[model samples]
Target chain A: MIKVRKLVKRFGLKTVLRGMDFSVESGEFVALIGPNGAGKTTFLRILASLARPSMGLVSVAGYQLPRQAADVRRRLGVVSHQPLLYVDLTAAENMTFYGRMYNLPNLNDRIDEVIELVGLTNRRNDLVRTYSRGMQQRLAIGRAVLHNPDVILFDEPYTGLDQDASAMLDEVLRTVAARGRTVVMTSHDLARTEDLATRFDVLSRGKIAASATHKDFGSGNLLSFYKGVLEEGRQN
Target chain B: MKKIIEDRSPLSLRERAEGEGKTPSGNYLRAIGAVAWKDLAAELRSKELLSAMLVFALLVIFIFNFALELDVKTRDSVTSGVLWVTFVFAGTLGLNRSMAIEKDRGCLDGLLLAPVDRSAIYFGKAISNLAFMLIVEIIVLPVYSLLYNTNLFQPGLLLIILLGSIGYTAVGTLLSAMSVQTRTRDVMLPILLFPIILPVVIAAIRASGAYLQNMPFDQILPWLNLLIVYDVIFIAVAFMVFDYVVEE
Candidate 1:
């Protein structure tokens, strides 16, 4: 559902993503984990069409990046650490606004369904600012998935969530993944990522340093695999 | 070309989303309306944007009233300049906050991620910014009249305010988007906006002064034409380049 080849993203003299090539099949949940300043967020931003690639080609759902961005955007749902929601608007109002932006049909019913999916049905009418951080993050999930996008990218989604909130977000993320949408999430929380992602790709020094599926890890844990990859990148 | 495409039996929104039917181009107007509606609704509930603008605007005029201490003829001569200054400053506040609301929580990215044309988002924002400026201007007018003890309700003056506001917000909306990304955003907007908007401000003040002084039609005609030309040119330029301004 997504492909990137030799993707190099540079800000002035500094290059963040250096010739990184990556891909994900439809319905695959890939977790791109990296330490800070590893170009993980930069890579995801390019994928989300929020930033242009300094070099390389990106195609999502068969439409190319930057050139075919509007078409690509129609299929993309992005959620960063920031909620990307108006705190003053109610959850339902926020949903309705995005629904109109996407020109959704049967928007009211879909809004209800998505609100229920994120467990915000009761608080749907409350202003987003009135909600707890968890509730707001949960509603952010609702906003991202509102239009039934084919590809959803989450960047450090669990940044500030407490334990209970993280658990709730895990449930929401699972429900979204179970719906057979392609998912690419970037984070440094190894334990949570190991629990949720079907495949793990380690990003270090602007490239995919290592990658393996959950089954391929066999009896080993992601922490050890992640450590080995960082050491490997350092040595090379 | 778009009118013909919009007339066809296009796919329903659901189908277009579910399949690879691309953007629902027919919803162009609808997208712009949705954004404007969203801005107005948020502003209505919060009142943060309007209240600040009104306070600053009223403050500007009151400060001018006290500082100038002009006689009736002097007041008549400076009225247009003072009014435009109040508007330019107040409009700056509105434009900055309007885009900041979008950027503060990453809502700008959310807007850009929509399936519609980027220009739709620009126009949507410009329309709402214009509305907010006009709302402040409307209130400022009467207050200026009350303070200055002068009649300020000429139809020609109102028209001049509308046209000047349209030009200001059109260019302001685009510049605010650019400046919002910088670290010194609050300082950046006026620096980028004021010089470019000189033509609009000058033409507006001249035309409005003519109206207030009851100058002859031939005398006001040139300033009026200048205002019209400036409005059309800037609005068109802003429309054509908004995609780049808002893009990363």
Candidate 2:
């Protein structure tokens, strides 16, 4: 349900994403793995309609990027490393506000359900500032899926989470993907991604260097495959 | 000619079926209100933005009181100018702080992700920034009156303050959105904002001065018109360019 071709992103003299192509089918959970500055976030932002590509043909759910961005945005849910939450407002308040923005129906019920899903029902009335990093991240997930969009882009959702938080997030991610939604998540944690994603796409030097299905690992695992791809990228 | 892309609603299919049945324009207005309400609620709770603006505004008036040891006549003549100056500086603080809150934790991105017109985000922020400026103005007028021993209660002057603030925050909101993406956003706002906001500042000062000095209605009319005109033009411009301004 997502397609990109010859995508190029540049900032003045620096070229970040060079003519790259990537695609994902419906209901596929894609884990985009790369090292720092490999443009994983940049690519996802372009798809999320948060950033425009310098040059590209990007479409999500049959809607074009940049041109049909608004329509694409309608089907898109995005969660970045930053919580994108108001610290001064309660979790419930944040959800309510975003719900109103989305013009969601029966928002109170949805907020309760999503808050419960994120396991923040008890703390829903508490200020986000009082919440821990993990709680904030969880609420961020709830905020992202509040609209129940067809596509969700998560960029390093596990960045600062503890082991327990990461584990909890894995469960949440599983639930989100289980709903038959298409998901694209970028991460450095290969093991976690290996467990969650149906496919792994290795992004290196602003291009998708290699891709494989979870089953393709066979006896080997994601780490070795990732390392192998990077080593190949370095050789080329 | 540029291609016109249709804006779409972000409501889920199921929710859209059971939803408010509001028209697109209705959704737009609600989104604007929702954004403005979000800002107001957060500020009301934290008082982080409002308190900082109030302290800075009060401090500016106090500093002016100590710095300008003018006789009653001179103080009256400069009252409008001083008030505009105070509003300008304090309004800058509010604008910067408002956008900073969004930028701090990627809340701006969150706002942008909404399926409404991007201008809704602009209008919403502009409205909230305007409210904060008006609130600060309401408090500052009394404090200025008590400190300088003059009445700032004139209807014409209050109108001028409102119009001036509408224009200030209109342009300031747009600039702050642009500046917030920069590294030195704190310094960037005023630098970008002050020069662009000159027409509003000058017009406000002149009209307010006319009101405070009890100038004839005819004498106040041109400055008054200028303030109104400036407000309309910039707000329109902000509406048109905000999508591009906040776009990366």
Best by lDDT: 2
TM-score of chain A of 1: 0.97
In model 1, what lDDT does residue B146 have?
Answer: 93
Please, what are the lDDT tens digits per residue for candidate 2 over residues B79-121? 9888998889989989999999998888999999988899999
TM-score of each: 0.95, 0.96
Looking at model 1, give its docking quality level.
acceptable
TM-score of chain B of 1: 0.91
Q: Model 1: per-residue lDDT, tens digit, B1-248?
A: 11111111346344555565444566888899999999999999999999999999999998998888889998898999999999999999999999999998889998998988888898899999999999998899999999999999888899989989988998899999999999999999999999999999999999999888989989888988888888888878887888888766
- How does model 1 score by TM-score? 0.95
Please, what are the lDDT tens digits per residue for candidate 1 over residues A102-165?
A: 8877789788888887878898999999988888888888888777777889999998999998
Q: What is the interface RMSD of each candidate, in Å?
A: 8.9, 9.4
The CAPRI quality class of candidate 2 comes to acceptable
Candidate 2 Cα errors over 4 Å, as ranges: B1-20
